[model samples]
Target: MDISIVLNLHDEAEYVSKTLESLEQAMVYAVKRGVQIELIVVIDNEKDDIGTIVEQFNFSVPSKIIKVKNCSLGPSRNDGISLARGEFVAVADGDDLVSANYFYDSFVFIKKLEKNKDRVIVFPEYVMHFDRFCFITKFVDSDQFSAEDFAYFNPYP
Candidate 1:
């Protein structure tokens, strides 16, 4: 199955290249696993040069840069999704770095499952910074589906 990574960005000129490089690594891993993936970078701010930076990245799969007037996260992501042509959509932040094997691992797990549109799977993330600090956070386990836990969790903006 093909996947589209909707990467949202604001004024991230300094970090765009690094983030995109990390994403490229994930895409390479996905390709090696026999999964197709594309990138749709949404520059939320019209004046941001993040789009220009995205142009420098060499991607094996389809990739595009979109600039939007609406700077909000939700709308920016919505705009990216509108241009997506993949069966599965993965939301990523421009400044965030994911593991190199993220896309490959996720696709492998998903491809083995039965088709169920209602099922949603989320992988845990670790927040990190250049200052050498990291916060590993867990949202849910395979066997744990607690409504009360989800009710209080605000995992995304």
Candidate 2:
């Protein structure tokens, strides 16, 4: 597989469907661009309807749902990543929605970095925050920020 999207779910029954739908669109877009993709959803809460929600979604790529008991986001994400078979891995939250071109755009950027590819991390250039308040934040390239800047503020949303 070229890319594996690991999505962490924790009691996000209200948003999981939309998130999965958005991810499916992204997967389809990437696949059309010749990027093989798979999805791994890690549910940290067994008591919620997240699993059922995920099962109802029609994913375009190979997908799996792993159940865990309250391990929180960090460990749940790690669990999903551990099972990923992709050459490149992308992380997502069950409540979030990404652009349809997200994976394809990232793939194009990664292909540009032919040397030291393993040392690079890809992040979206812009993030749209919603719900209570709405705002759009732009992220610069990693080299533009110093270590101290990261310590004081989060460059990536």
Candidate 3:
């Protein structure tokens, strides 16, 4: 069973390199645990110069860089959703750094729940960083699934 890391990014040139590095490093750990990761990087920002860094970055992640003109996270995610070929889906922001064992742990947990066969949606405990503080925010066990919960926000120009 494979997983798709739907990385949604806009003009994140400032911090994308570091994010990519962290993801690449995490992929190494995830792979060692027998997880096949497919990176769906949606570049809603610029594509031309983004390649300069993307190509130079050394990572073995099987990535398909989708360069969209001017799309928001909703459209970007929808686009990726259309082509997703994995059994499960996970999302990460452009600036956020995911844990090295994110995929490893998720895969194991999902397989354990025989009852919840395909309802494996485990978002990580967010590593929030404020002005001079940092902490983790865990995913809330949903009370219910409403359309508003996953509703699309305003689009980009």
Question: What's the TM-score of every candidate structure?
Answer: 0.82, 0.91, 0.77
Prediction-by-prediction clash tally: 0, 0, 0
Encode model 2's per-residue lDDT on 68-118: one tens digit a residue. Answer: 875678888899999999988999997788999999999877878846645
The 0-to-1 C-alpha lDDT of every candidate, in the order given, reads 0.78, 0.87, 0.73
Tens digits of per-residue lDDT for model 3 on 32-116? 8788888888778674466567657766767777777656789888777666777778787767787788788887788787456
* Candidate 2 to truth, TM: 0.91
Model 1 clash count equals: 0
The best candidate by lDDT is 2
- The candidate, 2 or 3, that scores higher on TM-score is 2
Candidate 1: list runs displaced more than 4 Å. 115-118, 125-134, 142-145, 149-157
Ranking by TM-score: 2, 1, 3
Query: Candidate 1 on 42-152: residue-level lDDT in tens?
Result: 888755566667777787778888778896999999999998888888888867788899888777677666355447675645555553554555444545655565588
Two-way lDDT contest, 2 vs 3, winner: 2
